[model samples]
Target: MLTYFRQRYPTRIEIDEDGNTVEVPLSDPMLEAKLHIALSTDGRHWFPLNANEPVWDQWMRDPYVRRGPDGVWRILTTGTTDGYNRDASGPGCFFASSKDLIHWNDERTLPLMEEVRDASGNFLANNIWAPEWFYDEENEEYILIWSSSFKDAGWKESRLWYSKTKDWKNFTPAKVFFEPPYSVIDGTLLKHENAYYLFHKEEEFGAKTGERRAIRLATSKKLEGPYQIVDGDLNDGQIVPVITEGPTIIEDPENSGWLLYYDYCMTNRYGASFSKDFLNWEILDDVHFPADARHGCVSKISSEEARTLINEYNISSSTDK
Candidate 1:
């Protein structure tokens, strides 16, 4: 079974001055964009796991779910608290673990940015975004990678940073993971045949820069890298649309190649591309996803586990395909 964990934006209906009913977005959409679940037998059709309600309702975004070697599922999300520094910047990302995917526990902040500092020994990051976990088989540890923007640059130049941990409780000091010439964020890794591919969003725009806000690729031999960008048609080697972000890739369930999916933010929909070599890609036009799903990762789950979640959440077959 295929499982998708994502952020959902809900709305409320209200009457206007003309007595017309209008769908109004939540008062604080970002805070309300909580974690939701969807399940699929095939990659093409999806069913909401909890009647379209958020499975983990909290102020979080960009939920990445991965099951560890210990048989526990863990989630790292873009979250924050009011107790940290009393500013707009998030002290760190949010974390939670579960033996089963339905009920989560041990929810807390990782405080990752606290360990990141400048030459003056002061914390430099103003925000932490899109934390993802990659397990290194050779090193026998998990590497947590995320994007951060420095205070010195007024949070303009976002780059990827990472830390290593065997247990989630303690992490190695945060350090620069990837610092390209241009601003980048939403970094996700794919390991194939002893090579590591990095898919990230180039967060630059405008006529002067001649850059686009789209997904780009970089590759390295080691998990942590001196990565070289793959040259392509778009500026800085982009592979997708001009207004896309939040890229996530999965092995095709019914095919040999891989499916790379991303959020078309400007159009409020999802798009996909397919690749077998990871060097050449074909944008797919007929793919489908659950309505309004945003910025999530896909993982395979056991059929028994999927059934349990479906029963617990009362997911109906009538949901959108």
Candidate 2:
């Protein structure tokens, strides 16, 4: 039997030495029904961890996974009926928890905007995309940030909005987190050596450059403060002025360098870059990642936690039949 291979992007370019181009064949369409957890041990080399049940049947995009104080893995993802980012509703972000990432609990939509209002004094948001939380140990507060469009912006511009909470039940008034001259989305923050680094995608386009959705960096002395666009070289000489989003930065546990990963949505794959001083980057090619993995945050977990999840879930690198 001859197997028919389908390309995710029909117009994807592939150049040869002589300047000849070819259409690249990407993923197999046979794997679409298997929605599994994308797990990686080395920030690269990702594999699909099959779930015993079809837990998420709908739109579960931009998943942010982190370990809570109660020693449980919690996930807050953008929830919608059609699995499209533009179709996100006002019920806020979706929430779920698990002890071993095998058996999930408390799966429901969290009303993050119910008690909070926008600049127009309205508590409604047209879209809620990629809700992520950062725990400040010193202040004992959870800083929640997500991309949303407002009535004043005519739902045309997406910006990063934030709220703080000690307990998830009660939240501080939502406010603008980062708004540049243009629009931005998929904001992720990292604190290193008393400085806060914010990574976000700026939505801009020009005649020369089409769909200028590039991941950029900003720095601030405080968590909520006047962050400025990072001066000097950012991508370590990498030409990344377009077609990137969902930048997730984490310190290399094995080394002193930092691993920065972004969704190369143009090619439908994740692209990674490594930096030591946060100014220069070495683009890592051929890093393994899940094909179906979308915008998601990564966290370091204990070895026991990974072992428990693998054992309980019967998770293998390959999809189960």
Candidate topping lDDT? 1
Alpha carbon deviation, residue 105, candidate 1 (Å): 1.6
Worst 10 residues of 2 by lDDT: 1-10
Global Cα lDDT for candidate 2? 0.64
Model 2 residue 104 CA deviation in Å:
2.3
RMSD of each: 6.8, 7.4
lDDT of 1 by residue, 86-156 (tens): 14333688889999887889998887878666687666777778889998989889999998887433125
Error of 2 at 235 (Å): 9.1
Worst window of 10 by summed lDDT in candidate 1: 81-90
Q: Backbone clashes per model, in order?
A: 0, 2
160 Cα displacement, candidate 2 (Å) = 0.7
Which portions of model 1 miss their true places by more than 4 Å?
Answer: 1-31, 81-90, 118-121, 151-155, 234-236, 316-321
